[model samples]
Target: MKKVLLYLKSYWKFALLAALLMGVEVTMDLLQPKLMEKIIDIGIAGMNLDFVLKTCLLMIGITIIGLFGGVGCSIFSTIAAQNIGADLRNDLFAKIQSFSFKNLDELNTGNLITVLTNDINTIQRIIMMGLAMMVRSPLLVIGSFIMAIITIPKLSWIIVLITPIIVAVLLTVNKRVYPLFYKVQQKLDQINTVIQENLAGIRVVKAFVRSNHEKERFRQSNEDYMLANITANQTMAVVMPLMILILNLAIVAVVWFGGIEINQGNLQAGSVIAFINYLMRLLQSLTMLGMVLIDISRATVSANRVENILKIEPTIKADHKQDDTFEIKGQIIFEDVSFSYDEDGEPTLSNLNFTIEAGETVGILGETGSGKSTLIQLIPRLYDVSSGRILIDGRDITEISPKTLRKQIGLVLQEAILFSGTIKENIGFGTGQISDQEMVEAAQIAQAEEFISSFKDSYDSPLSQRGVNLSGGQKQRLSIARTLALKTPILIFDDSTSAVDTKTESLILEALQQKRKDTTNIIIAQRISSIIEADKILVLEDGQITAIGTHQELLTTSKIYQDIYNSQFAKEEKNYA
Candidate 1:
């Protein structure tokens, strides 16, 4: 909580102004009971109607003054709290963006989403409410206690006695509620994970006719979340009634003692009335303090969650200080490169040694779990190799700034991800200051131009989220176009054309062969036909490269290659029949 509150340093002036205004409001509140006592004892008791009217006017004016103070405090507190929230959220997002792929894998997407939105919102709310109530409540309690002592010294003991009891209850509640609220946030993360997975794979669920299963899964998650919330609230619910009971009992004791003093003629009626008023104010402040404890407990948990993300140092760091004069010719060399997702786990890619000359079109072939995707992902430095080195153009990739290296390589993953935007914007997504001709040319190269032209709005046609409105094949083409638009010196296609038909896929490969002949292209494909024309092919099995050769050369020499080609060839012949 202390670390998170450091964001408030930038907005201290606004916060200070809010505290000062609260002081002014509290002063006005403290003066009210004293003024009422003066009116009743001097003006009303002496039958001075003129004095009574004047005192009433003064009280009204004081209330107006206090109203301005209260309103100003609220406005300034909001400004400070909102700015703090904005800064904290922006920093948190920036930190997440810096995280390495390994960090992301461990953190998970759903939990990060919850931390960004729900958890930060909790911190923001508590800050806004705390600024107003925390200051006002404490001041009211102390100020009212002092006024009560001044009004009747004999009854001051009641306040001193009641305060310790209220403090004890608040302390106990804080200890119990913190753990419950932490559990509540964990359950919320679970609910969010279920929703995210269900929504993202909604089509798959429907295709498999598992809608009832998804509903049951969601129902179970929602019930756990609800039960967690109920338990926390049930614990918190004990506070208000317990506080009210203490307040009512204290008030009764005051009234009882005051009446006895009145009969003995030791205390005036006006003084007794003022003392009772001050006592209520003092007790009510304690009640508000109890409420503030709940906010503090919940915010503490949120603060810790937010801080956890902020404190994590990204596993991968790029050397921004590296010289900018070096140029990449796209020649890649993997020297004894090996990687494992876990330190003690089996290697995904093991002792891999290979090289691709600049502008060479290379094919990577592997069966399921052969680490095809993992091999290419290492080139972009998405996940650093656990051992050995990967060099691009004779420079270790780690020595180059990630921003500089990634900009020169265009990578399209197996899954085609598109945002909700116009077709033009999707193609020209990150390549800044691109012209219309460039967008058209890239789309043409990816064979997406024909389908794009069919739309009524053409390039201006809007796409749904993840391009769900487009066919699977169309989405793949657009994903290719988006990467092609970068015109990077190196290109990686991780089975990005699997959804497209053979005709379209062949056209896209032919276009790349013709137009992007000068760029290095690494294509990972399941179908042998997809990479049959490549300059060289790599056959991988169990994290080891089994063979490396051209298409006809591999068919003659490599049995694994032969098995794949024969199986795919047989399937093609059967389809042709």
Candidate 2:
């Protein structure tokens, strides 16, 4: 709550101004009822035209002031709400971007989306209403009650007795509705998760012929969301009718008691009428107060959800301060490194140690879950090691700022992710300017030049989200081109060439040899031929290094390497005929 409140501190002055205008509006409303009593008893009944005219003109002027006050209050409230909302949305997105892979694993994407959009909008609406009616409604309720008591003192006890009963009923109804709203938010998160999963993997879903199953899944989530909302609405629906019923009983008491006083010559007709008007205002404000409390109840749940995200301290922050001017030459060393996704679970990569001198190409071969991807991810500090240390140029990676560290390293994951933009823009995304010559060189190395040039727009052709318009091999090459364009000292490819043919893969490797021979490279591949010619290869089994040698050295000494070599090459030799 405190973290969420800090976002509103900058807009406090505007919020206050809007609340003050709302107070003025409420004050104008209260004064008119009192003036009506005078117009009825003193002007109309007394046969005085001059006094009636003056009072009517005064009422008209006050009404205009009230109208202007309401309009000004709404304008100010909107400004304050929008400013807070923009700041909050930007802050939430920035915080999410700051999260490490581990942090993301703890918080799912669908929940984050729900909080950023729906929950933040909920808080914004509350701010607008809090600035406008939240202040005025309570004031009007209190002022109306006091004026009613003054107008008919003998019947004032009727209001005093009934106010507590109305309040109790409101509290009873609101308590049940308040807790149900949390379930509504949770259900919304589930629905968003299903929708995001379906859209993101639509190809896999349809290819597997699971469309009916997916539809059922979505139907279940949608039905749950609707039911949760229906329950909340049904619970809140009791407050208004319950409030009006209690109010009518109070009104009946006031009218009956006041009639006796009027018959006894203790109260004037004007006083009875004024008291009834004040009672109406009192009931109306009380009704609005009930509705606002319900709004606050729901908004409170959303605020807490939003506040949870704001309060998360990234576990993988760069806590080790170091001199910013130090240069790194990309000499990577892993000493007794171990890592686990769960703190208490078994390590994914355990007690592994290796070194790579600058400009050396190292290949990693391992089966799935053998920690091939996890090994390279540690060098960039995407997830910190559970134990031991990694040093770049003899400096512990903890000491290097993530921005500076990642600036010097380029990574291409197994799944390529491309934004919706021109091919030139994607390759030049982080490298600043890319002359036609630089782009062509990078594309040639990635083996993407032939296909990209085939398009009418060439380098200017636009891509869809995640490069969906491109084929699997084309997407991988474009992804490779993007990384190659960075011109970083250290580049890591984690099974990034699985989709390309052997011939294209060989051509891409040949192009890289000619264009970027000096760049330190680490290639992780499932196929033996992909990494057989590396300067050194590390064979992994169950997170342990079983063998580390050149292809020729491992072909004689390591049985696993021999099996992999034979399995991939024997088939190719047979197909050559």
Candidate 3:
């Protein structure tokens, strides 16, 4: 709640003005009934035409003024609510952007999307109503009550008796529905997660012929969300009927007693009419007020969810004082670094120590789960070392902020992710000021130029979400091109070229050798042919570096390396026969 309210401070002035205008509107609404009393009891009773016309003109003037006040209230409330929403949305997205990979693991992508879009929109609706209807409803209720008491004291007891029952009803409904609303939101997250997975893996689902299975899966999630929503609505659905019953009963009591008052000369006919008018207005306000409270109940749940995002401190804190202008020459050192996803679980990489000189090409080869990806990720502080330290250019990487360090290192992970954009735009994503020539050069190096030019639009060809229009190998090559365009001193390919064939992979490696030979390159590959020419090859088995030497030296000394070589090239050599 504290964090969520911080956004309101920026628009408090507009909100205050909206509240003031709403007050004026409600005040004018209250005044009209009193003016009706005077026009009926005095002007019409005495048949004073001038007095009636004067009151009529005055009422028209007040109505027009109230209309302007209502319009102004609406305008200011809209501006304030929209600006606050925009700020909240932007701030939330930026916060998510700074979250560590570990943080993302806790908050799934679907839940984060729901909070950013749907939850924030809920807060906006509540804010807009809070500034507009929230102010008007309470004012009208209180003003009507006070005016009814002053106008006809004899009939005001009914209002006093009825108000408490309505308040109790609202409070009861709020309590019963708040927890149910939270469940509804979680159900919504589940529905969104199911949809996201289906769409992202639509091809896999189709190839496996699981459309009917997927439909049933989605149907179950949807039914759960529907059930949760209906349960919450069922609890809250009683509020209006109870309020109306109480309000109508109060009106009945007013009419019953006021008739006797008028018959006994204790109340004027006009006074009874005016009191009834105030009662109806109070009824309308209370009805709206009930809905406002229900919405407020729901909004509070969303507010807490959004606030959790704002309140959670990122696991990774960047060093603000680090010099952004400082350069990295790509000299890397890892001394006894150990890491595990779960702190209590077995280490992914344990007590590993290695050094790569500047402008060196080091190869990392291991079986699955040997932590090849984890090893390269530590250099950029994607995940900090669990035990020891990593150094770049003789400075501790942890001492250097992630932003400053990552800018000099380019990483292409095993997964190929591309946004919906032009081929040139995707390649030039991070490399600012990339001309057509640079785009072409980067594509050539990644060996993606031929297929890109085959399309009629060439670099301008549009891409769909995740570049689904491209084949797996094309996506990987495009990802590589994006990294190469940055021209960073250090590049880590975490099996990024696995989808590309050996011929294209050979061409890409050859291009990298000619174009960026001085760049410190780290290659994580399964095939032995890919890393045979590396200056130093580290053979990893079960998170331990068993051999650190040239490929030739590993073949002679490390049985694991020899076995891998035999499984790959030795079989290939025999197949050629």
Candidate 4:
């Protein structure tokens, strides 16, 4: 909570101004009860019409001054709170962008979204409320209490007796509701997770006829979220009535005792009336403060959540001390590299020792879960090796800046992700600037230009979110085109062409060989034909390299490669027959 409050440092002036204005409003409010006492005891009792009228005018003028203070406070508080929210949100997003793949994996997308949007909004509102009421309530309470004591010191014991009970109630409610609000935020995360999953995979749900199942899943999550909210609100709702009951009882005690004092010679009617007014102001301010404290409790929970994100240092940070001015030649060496998603778990790629020379085309063949994707991911430093080192050129990859290193390597993940935009924008998403000729050339190389040109708008055609309007093959082609546009010295395709036809895949591979011959290429593919002509192929089984040779050499040298080639070849022959 304290860490998150630093966001207000830049806007503290506005917050302080708001608080000062609120104090003006509270001062006016406190003075009004005392003026009423003057009107009753001095002006009315003495039968002086001029004094009564003059005091009434003064009260009206004070009310007008207070109105300006209240309005100014609102404007400044909004400025302070809104700016703080925006700055905090922007910083949080920037921090998330700096996170490594492992960090992202550790933080759930749903939870991150909830914290960035809902939790931040909660803190923003509390800041606004606090800036206004935080000053007003305490000043009003203290001023009113002092005036009440000065008015009738004997009657002040009623307030002294009631204050402890209100404080006790407030403390109890605060303890009970903090955990509930925390649960509410967690439930909201679950709701968001369910919604995000359903939307992202809606096509799969429809294809599998699992819409009903998804609906049930969403229904259950929503209900849980709703129940959590209701439980928290119900706890707060109970506190409100209990507080009002205590307040009303205190007021009744004041009225009862004040009547007795008035009947005696100790208190006048005007004094009794003023004392009741002061008592109401003081107690009501305490109640309002109680409500603000409850809100502060919720905001504290949200602050901690936001603070947790801000406190996280990205697992991978670029070393600025290393000289990164040297040009990359695309020679990648993995020396005794090993990695695991979990520290205690088995290594996903154990003792990976390989060297791909500059401008060489290397194909990686592995069974499912052989860590093919993981291996490619390591090349881009998406996830660093748990043990050992990767060398680019001759320097350890850790010595190079990640941004500079990634710029020289073009990676196409197994899943092709496209943002909502025109085809041209999608192609230029990474490089930022591409001439029409360059864009067309990349699309052609990926075997995507033919289908793309068929559209009325061609490259200008708009794409739905994640390119849902395009086929799997088209999206994969676009993904390849996007990466190919970079024209990096090192290219990695992690099953990027699997969805395209064999002929299209062949064409793309031929294009890559012709156009990027001077660039190193690493391809991970399931099909033997896709990698048959490669200069070298790696056969992997259970995260270990079983074979490394040309296709014909592998057929004779490696049992795993032979088995894969024979099974695939036999299936093709049987289909043709």
Candidate 5:
């Protein structure tokens, strides 16, 4: 609750104005019953028509004032709530962006999506309801109690006696419902996780003909979510009816006692009527207050979830002094580097020592799970080495800021991902501003220009989400083109050309050799042909570098490299035969 209140500090003025309006509205509401009492007792009782007419008009005017105040407060509260939600969401997104790869790995994409969208919405509603009702409901309850005492002192004991019971019941219900609401939210996150997985893997599910199995999984999650919500709401369902029952009983007691007083000529009819109105208003306010508590409980859980993410300190911090003024020479050296995904996990890479000189190309070959991808990931500090250091141009990678280090390297991953946008925008993603010639040249280098030109809109053609409209080879080519357009000094291609044909692959390699004279290239590939001409080749086996030398040197000296080469070329030799 305190954390949520702190978020509203930026909009204190709007909150204050809303409070003031609510106060005015409550004051006007309290005055209305009193004026009605005056019209009935002083004017009607004395048969004074002018006084009754005037009091009625005054009551109407006060009603209008109350209505205006109510609307004004609502508008202010809504605007304040929206602004707070927007600011909080923006801050959350920025914080997520700043987190290191390890941080993101700890938080799954689906859970983060839930926090950003659903949880934020819950907090917004709570803010709006809390601000709007916090002042008015309490004021109505307390004001009506005081007004009731003054109007009919004998009957005021009934309110004093019954109000405590009602409060106790509400508190009990809140205590039980609060934990259930938290559980409901957890179930909702699970449902979201299931939905997200299904959408992302829908093709795989269909390929395996497991749609029914997936549907059952989703149905189970949805059922759990429904059951949780139903349980929470069912518990809360006790509140309003019990409140109405207590209110009716209080009304019965008032009328029964007031009739006796009226027969004895001790209490007037107008005062009794006014007291009943005040009691009903008091009950209505109390109901709204109970509802507010329910919202606050749910919001409290949601705010805590959001705050947890916001409070996560990034593992990687940028150096304040590091700047991009110095140009990269594209030299990279890893000295006895070791790494693991987690503290408890076995090392993924061990004693990894290698060096690639400026303008040189190095090829990395390893079986799956041999840490080939993990090795390159360390170059940009995506995941820091658990031991040893990586250097670029004799400067430790850690000493350089991530922004500067990444700006010097262009990477193409095994899975080519594209956002929903035009081809031109996807190619020029983070370059700030790009010229048409540069975009075209990069596309041509990656052999993507031919297909791009075939499109009716050329570079302006809209891409579906994740470039779903493009073929696997086209997407891979575009991803390569996107990275190439950055023109960074260090290029890391992690099996990015696996989808391209042998002819196209040759063309891309030729282009890289011609255009990347000053760029250090790191190629991770399964095909020996992709790296046979490299300056150096390193063969990894079970997280250890078993062989490191030129392709011909390894082929002659290393049995593992020799076997891999023979196995691949043997197939080609048979095809020629």
Candidate 6:
């Protein structure tokens, strides 16, 4: 709540103006009934047509004023709500970007998506509704009560008695409904997760003919989401009818007692009529108050979720004290570094140490689950070292600003991800002002220029979402080209060429050698041919480096490397016959 309040503080001026306009609107509304009472009791009863005409015109003018005020309030509140929602979403996105990979591992992408879209929308609606109703409802309730007392003091007691009862009922409903709404939001996150997964992996689902299974899973999630929403709406549904019933009972009492007063000449017919109007207005405002409470409850829940994200301090923060610029020679050293996903789990890498000089190519080869990716990720500080230090040049990676450190390295993962954009845009993603010549050269180096040129639009051709229009090898080549376009000093290719044929792979390797002679490279691949020419190869087994040597040295010494080489390339070697 405090966090949300702080976020809203920036727009309080607009909120205040909206509140003031709503107050004026309610004041005009409350004044109308009083004027009607005046026309009826003092003008019509006294047979003064002039007084009635004058008062009716005054009422019309007040109504016009109220309408204008209402319109202004609506405009201001809508603007404020939209701005608040935008600011909140921007803050959430910034927070997500700042989080370390370890933090991201704990949050689902789908859940974050829901928070940025659905949850923020919910909170914005609540804020708009709150600003529109908060001041007006209370004014109507209290102003109507005061007018009633002035008109018929005896009848005002009914309002005093019934208002609290209505409030108590609303509070009770709110208490029960808030938790259900919170649960509903959680269930919504799950549904989003399932939908996102299915959309991303629809091809796999169809390939295995598991569409029915996926559908069933979606159905279960959808049903749970539906049930949660129904439960919350149903609980809130009770508040209105019960409020109406209580208001009706209060009306009956007012009429029953006022009739006696009229018979005894204690009250006029005009007062009775005006009192009933005020009673209805009061009841209507109380009902609006109930709705405001409902919105408030839901907003409270959403605000808490948003605040949870905002309050999470990123494990990775830029070192403000350190110089932003460093002469990076790309010398990477890991000194006795150890890491584990969880404290209770065995360490993925323990006491691992290695050093690579600038302008060197190092290959890491290992079976699945051997922490090959984790080992390379440390240099870029994707995940912090759990128990040791990683140095870039002579400076600890942690001591340097993350921006500076990452700007020095370019990474291409095994899974190539492309956003919906043109080929040129994807290649020049980070710094969007690359020259056409630079883009073409990078694509040529990745062996992607020929295919890109095959298209009629070439660089300007539109890419489908995630580059689904491109083949797997094309995507990998484009992803590599995108990395190369950055021209960073240290390049990390995590099985980047796995989808390309040997001929294309050889061309890319040749390009890398010819074009980036001074750059340091780290290659992680399953194919022995992929890393055969690396300056040095590190063999990993069970999260430990088993052999560190050239390929020929490993072939003579390491049985594991020999077997992998023999199985993958021995046939090709024989085919040379």
lDDT of 4: 0.90
Global local distance difference test of model 6? 0.89
Question: Evaluated with lDDT, which candidate comes out highest?
Answer: 5
Better of 1 and 6 by lDDT: 1
lDDT of 1 by residue, 110-136 (tens): 888898899888888888888888999
List TM-scores for all candidates, in order.
0.97, 0.97, 0.96, 0.97, 0.98, 0.96
Cα lDDT of model 5 by residue, 60-109, tens digit: 99999999888989889998999999998999999999999999889987
Off by over 4 Å in 6: 573-577
- Writing each residue's lDDT as its tens digit, candidate 6 over 1-577 gives 6787676788989999999999889999988878888898899899999999999999999999999989999899988999999999999999998999889988888888888899899989988888999888988989998988888998778878887888788778888987898899899999999999999899999999999999999999999999999999999888778877887888788889999998999988788888988988988898788879878878887888899999898887886786579768888888999988777789998888888899999999999889988888888888888898998887888888888888879999879999899999999996678999999999999999999999999999999999999999999999999999989999999989989998899899889999999899999998888888998999988889989899999999999999988887878878776
The sequence of per-residue lDDT tens digits that candidate 3 reaches over residues 1-577 is 5677678899999999999999989999999999999999999988998999999999999999999889999999988889988999998999998988777778877888889989999998889888999999999999999999999987777888877777777777777887898899999999999998898899899999999999999999999999999999998788777777777787778888998988888877788888888988887798788778878878888898898998878887786776677699989999998999878999999999999998898999999889999899889888878999998998988888788888899999889999999999999998766999899999999999999999999999999989999999999999999999999999999998899998899899989999998899999998878888899999888898989999889989999888898889778889887
Q: Once superposed on the true structure, which residue ranges of model 1 sit more than 4 Å away at CA? A: none
Q: Check candidate 3 and list the clashing pairs.
A: none
Give the per-residue lDDT of model 2 (tens digit) for 1-577. 5677677789888888898888889889988878888888798889898999999999999999999889889999999988988998999999999999999899978888898999889988988987798988899999999898888888888788878887788778777877788788889999999998899999999999999999999999999999999999998878778777877887788778878887888876777788888888887888788879888877888888888898898987755475455566768898999999899998898888888888888899988989999999999899999999999989988888887888888999888889899999988877889888888888999999999999999999999887889999999999999899888889999999999998899898877777888888899998888887888899999888889989999999999999988987898899996
Candidate 4 lands at a TM-score of 0.97
lDDT of each: 0.90, 0.87, 0.89, 0.90, 0.91, 0.89
Per-residue CA lDDT of model 4 for 1-577, tens digit only, reads 9988888999889999999899889888888888998999899989999999999999999999999999999999999999999999999999999999999989988888889999999999999999998998889889988999999898789878887998788788878887888888888889998888888788899999999999999999999889998998888888778877887887788778878877886777788788878888887888789889988988998998999999899998877786567578999998999999989999999998989999999999998999999999998799989999999888898888888889889999999999999999999999999999999999999999999999999999999999989999999999999999998999999999899989999999999999888999999999999999988999888888989999999999999898998999999999889
Would you list the clashing residue pairs of candidate 5? none
- Residue 310, model 1: lDDT of 95
Candidate 6: how many backbone clashes?
0
Stretch of 10 with least lDDT, candidate 2: 318-327
* Native-structure RMSD, model 5: 1.3
Question: What's model 4's lDDT at 245?
Answer: 88
